[model samples]
Target: MSIIVRDFQPADAEAAAETKRAAIPYLVLTPELVAWQVTHAPGNQRHRLLVAEVDGQVVGSASTGIFAESSKPGQAFVNLSVAPDARGRGAGTALLTTAEGYLTGLGASTAYAWVLDDEASTGFAQRHGYQRSRSSYFSRLDLAAIALPSLPPLPEGARLRTAADFADDPRPLYDLDVEAAADEPGDVDSDAMNYEDWLALYWHRPDLDRDLTSVVVMDGMAVAFSVAQTDRRGRYWSGMTGTRRAYRNRGLAKQAKADSLRRARLAGCSEAFTGNDAENAPMLAINGWFGYQVAAREWRYLRNLTD
Candidate 1:
């Protein structure tokens, strides 16, 4: 009957990852990634993983940290997840309270979170003084059921490549990521990530599956790509599918997705998941082309930390 919140230890990685999986089914989460978040945060920044224990069992976790790479300061984030079976035990509220206090101590002026688009979840955010902002839709594709669509033929000068092909020089891919990310819709303006930051943040992440990540190279330039992440189980996630601005409308993004997904299924990934901002009509259309169905929706919430 007792619940307590504590700092996460290295040993809590598996249980914490499992707790989050149970809370959000469509997310591509793994213990390695969970642990990496704690270990890879910038040394000078404030970051912590808070775990909720109920009768000695870990039932929820909150990832709290400052947005160190944002163009604006005082932007912090908390992503809290509690196992469905343990929801009513006050674990969620306790975790959120602790997380907010930690962010406040770090001088954060704004705290942001993504809450499930349901009455209970939204109400909880409202009660905590968080205001609704934007929403995104999570979608899933049955890689094990439907056969993947064939990759469309690329124009004569362009061809398909896997992320693995750039093992020695990934700078081109990094350029593509930056160009695409700058156009992504979000509440905070993100500072442009340098090569080293991208390496630590994305390229070197344990969950990135290079062989399954498809890239479209036109004249030796990375013009479009589909970044793939895996749990190394049966779940695969489309981390991002993006094309350079000039490359749009040519079905290159679709080609990238189809190529990446086909490879994923061949590698034994049974399901694929992705999220798109509600206003991103282009990517939404591309996902729809691949038969991805809406799995869930999450609304972004923000709270001002001061009076």
Candidate 2:
């Protein structure tokens, strides 16, 4: 069988998305979202999606790009996935090598990738000189069946509202997102400034559930929020949960998350998943309090692109 790896075309979005779903089940992926990512990713992101084909059937995919949002320069990411049924082939290695070369040429000095916490995946990364780093687990809760925490009454002078409530002006949402992202723990930085981009890429994205995305408003400003995403099948995921610095220690984050989760359950969503960096002790503690258990783990592996 002739095998080839090449840049992803618009036509390949569906197959590439399917490959990603097979490789990383925890991620809530859809063809429309995949295509939107390709079309809306900032030019600075240096984003490129690639596919591996064997005898004309796509069997693997890789997302290679610079972490432009990151404050640090020279940092990039190359994540590759091979279909479970197609793993024996060289598609994975081919995709990885090609993606690495592409990012390296783009001036990336260090590239990080996520590999499943399994023997074969870990072995592949180790053999490629990638060092394993912190690992994070994906957890899922039965939103429809599980008993959600009793949401506390909105604190005095504070009110809960959906993202949709700010339809006329999303700047508050943007500000909240930026502040929360700045506090998030991760290898790469995330600086979200362009409101138009966030609108196109996030607000208008197919998965974002604005109705279920709860925000805490105190007086006249948004202070805390929990972004929610629901799949085509009603499966829910906590896209992000954060509280602004000025409002921290007030338990607002917990309130927003609880309200969002409760809303998701009422919306017929059975499963709710969320991810947390292992180093994020506060968020982890909050999720644990909500009875979210670890379902799967992924380790970040980094390789010096120049080497």
Candidate 3:
């Protein structure tokens, strides 16, 4: 009954994703997506995925990487998960230790992690010398049960388009993403400055459902969008829903989300999920209007490696 932590292998994709799903059901994870994350990560991110095996069976996983998009230096993150049935073992501690060592080797001065807002989870983080920081809410909506709001009539010159419409030229969407992400609340500031990096790390992600991702276009410009990710397994996730700063208060964000939700339902998605920073009141209110209820909360924990 020995637990060993090692670098994740391609063959472990399914077992790794299953472990993550059992530990955090709200996430939309699949073997293909997991493999994409490990194999196609941006060079600057220094990403590494680790798996914990107990008696030759994978039971937990951890993902660690530097926040390449953040303007701040030395910022890194580690997300660890252990299957429910595998708890009470030392797998989690081993995984965390290995992840931290890897991040340290990458010159990371600070490490951040998201821990479920519960006694056991928080206690484990605290025991590891991590302090609670900002919190985020995970919300889920029953697409099959809730009646989606009708899409608002677009402004005189505005039209709704799917992300696929930008397959030939995604620069417009990239610009909008950069603008919206800069305004998002978070501990580390992210700029999404490099288009090529964005393409590899986000736009080209295997889980991104371009057909379901709705974009708002006014005249000849892309103003807002709701990025959607689906597993075609009856689950849908709102990756990002934002309106350019210039177009705020025009209901563009809401419209984009509405259109995306309708598309998801029409595509046979049963459940929809999203997450928001606790301080993001406007987005939270918008999600509430869509009938998304808070399913869980996680507190961001940080530790200074130099401490």
lDDT of each: 0.90, 0.86, 0.94
Worst 10 residues of 3 by lDDT: 148-157
lDDT of 3 by residue, 83-157 (tens): 989987899999999999998888899999999988888999999999999999999999999998765588888
By TM-score, who's the top model here? 3
Cα lDDT for residue 271, candidate 3: 99
lDDT of 1 at 72: 80
User: What ranking of all candidate models by TM-score puts the best one first?
Assistant: 3, 1, 2
> What is residue 179's positional error in candidate 1, in angstroms?
0.7
TM-score of 3: 0.98
Candidates 1 and 2: which is better by TM-score? 1
Candidate No. with top lDDT: 3
lDDT of 2 by residue, 1-307 (tens): 8789998888988898898889888888888888878788878888998899999999999888987666678989999999899996788889988998898788899999988999989999999899988888798776666776676687799999999999899899988888888878877768744676667657888889999999999978999999998875777888889998989988999999998888887888888889988898999888988888888989999998777
Candidate 2, which ten residues in sequence have the lowest lDDT sum? 192-201
Model 1 agreement with the true structure over 1-307: per-residue lDDT tens digits: 9989999988999999999999998999999899997888665447899999999999999999887657688899998999999987799999999999998898899999999998888998999899999999999999999866666578889899999999999999999998888888888765646777678778988999999999998866999999999999989999888999998788888988898999899899999999999988889988888899999999999999985
lDDT of 3 at 160: 94
Q: What ranges in model 2 sit over 4 Å off?
A: 191-197
Compute the lDDT of residue 78 as modeled in candidate 2.
Answer: 90
